[model samples]
Target: MPVHRSGSGTTRRSRLAALGTLLAALSLLLTLPGAATAADSPTAAAKKPARGSATMGMGVIAHDGRGGLPGGTLVAQTEGVDVSSHQGNVNWATLWNSGVRWAYTKATEGTYYTNPYFAQQYNGSYNVGMIRGAYHFATPDTTSGATQANYFVDHGGGWSKDGKTLPGVLDIEWNPYGAQCYGKTQAGMVSWIRDFVNTYKARTGRDAVIYTATSWWTTCTGNNAGFGTTNPLWVARYDTTVGTLPAGWGYYTMWQYTSSGPYVGDHNHFNGALDRVQALANG
Candidate 1:
């Protein structure tokens, strides 16, 4: 844009005054409390996801809530719940009394975050006589799956065959923090997941459970079916039915039925009875 510059005194003075006023306004904006600066710009803010701030099934309700309430018979299904730092310290007694027989707590996210409330949520569930496990929120963009798995294990994603501790879960769903598939292609996503689950198994001598929503799985791995054999599936669908699962899994080991389920956190159901939950824990 070309500006017409005049040699006339009045025009020059007017231009100088206008420039001074603009600078003063900018200075005022900078001094204002809570004002947005370059560092707080929307574009700058979107680049970084808070480390260690995610939980299990974080994206399910938002992405796949179209399932429309849980449907079918829950008769023999075991009741469970999954919690994260968002739930803070859980009241396990309330959950247990509500017939929640199993539970999972967020253990770690990528290699950067470990749940601060892990001990309380994990141990409290066990002490209350509920079979419990831990889950790792996968951030495939930040680190290799193996590194994350080790971090998860080091933090809290360990297993014990005490008939009370279920295997850790790998939460590889919609990336709430960044790219939909962590900016990876379907094949790349699969390999990353493979690395994480493999490393988790190698470190703990137990297969890691994989938690995901069907839509994300389909979009991310093109609905890859390779993991159904070794890892147990924990499918999330916030509706009346469990709905369609990802390509590889024949059955879901656990179903996260509703984020609005009774009691605390997101409620879930083991595919079978209490003994089945115990069996997974024992393994």
Candidate 2:
């Protein structure tokens, strides 16, 4: 499970401190022109839509309920939320009105489980002008990584560089089952992750973002640095501070700060400027 419930007792001021750090880092990244945008592949232009004049912004407001930003500025960082079937019939417009600007809806799990609410959640968010993406709950032990990746892609988990569509994410965290590591050895787990990511790239032409915790990664993959250079790390640390990241990652691409946030579900942060978040959507 994510550290969502661990830091409920953390003070709001402490949380603000953490947010300050994130905002500063993101502001610095924004200064470097084209720093956040990755080089496009040969086929990228054909698949990605033309950039629009309006840029999307995901806002994380203070506790005042007035939607005020961290430093009273609008473009510091992007805010988003991730949802699953558990959050049924989301009032996406209401969420947009409440400062959420992007979303990642759960699409599939293993090869059998698919979120029935995926279309509504994913499309609804996009219809309302929110950048949207889909994620797959990986079950590497149940099947081969390539097989699961294909299943995920076939079932609404593929990505298009449509300026507002983010690349798919692989939610590889603790198994609700008894075996947290999915019954695989350290080396086996690394191999499975590589296979899944490779197949996902071939199918979607975008690197699949990885969502996990440091402790889980260390225990399961022996702190493997294999995905560090290629895949973006979406670290889940629900404390007032982000803990030490998994090995080989100098910084996180996204952070799941809290599940019990002001929003409807797990609240996340895109660790860069508004354009950077939109850049990911462009593949």
Best by lDDT: 1
Summarize candidate 2's per-residue lDDT along 1-283 as a digit string, tens digits: 3465556546666889999999999889877876654443455555432321100111111211122223333335678898887788789988899888889998888887778788899999999999999888887778999999999899998887679999988888766543678899999999999999999999989999998887788889999987888999998776656669999899888887776777587787788877888988896
Instruction: Give the alpha carbon lDDT tens digit for every residue of 54-154 in model 1.
Output: 66766775566535556666778988999999999999999888889889999888777788888999999999999989998899999999999999999
Instruction: Give the residue spans of candidate 2 off by over 4 A.
Output: 1-75
* Each prediction's whole-model lDDT (CA): 0.87, 0.78
The ten-residue window of minimal lDDT in model 1 covers: 1-10
lDDT of 2: 0.78
lDDT of 2 at 69: 22
In candidate 1 the C-alpha lDDT for residue 264 amounts to: 77
> For each candidate, what TM-score against the reference?
0.83, 0.73
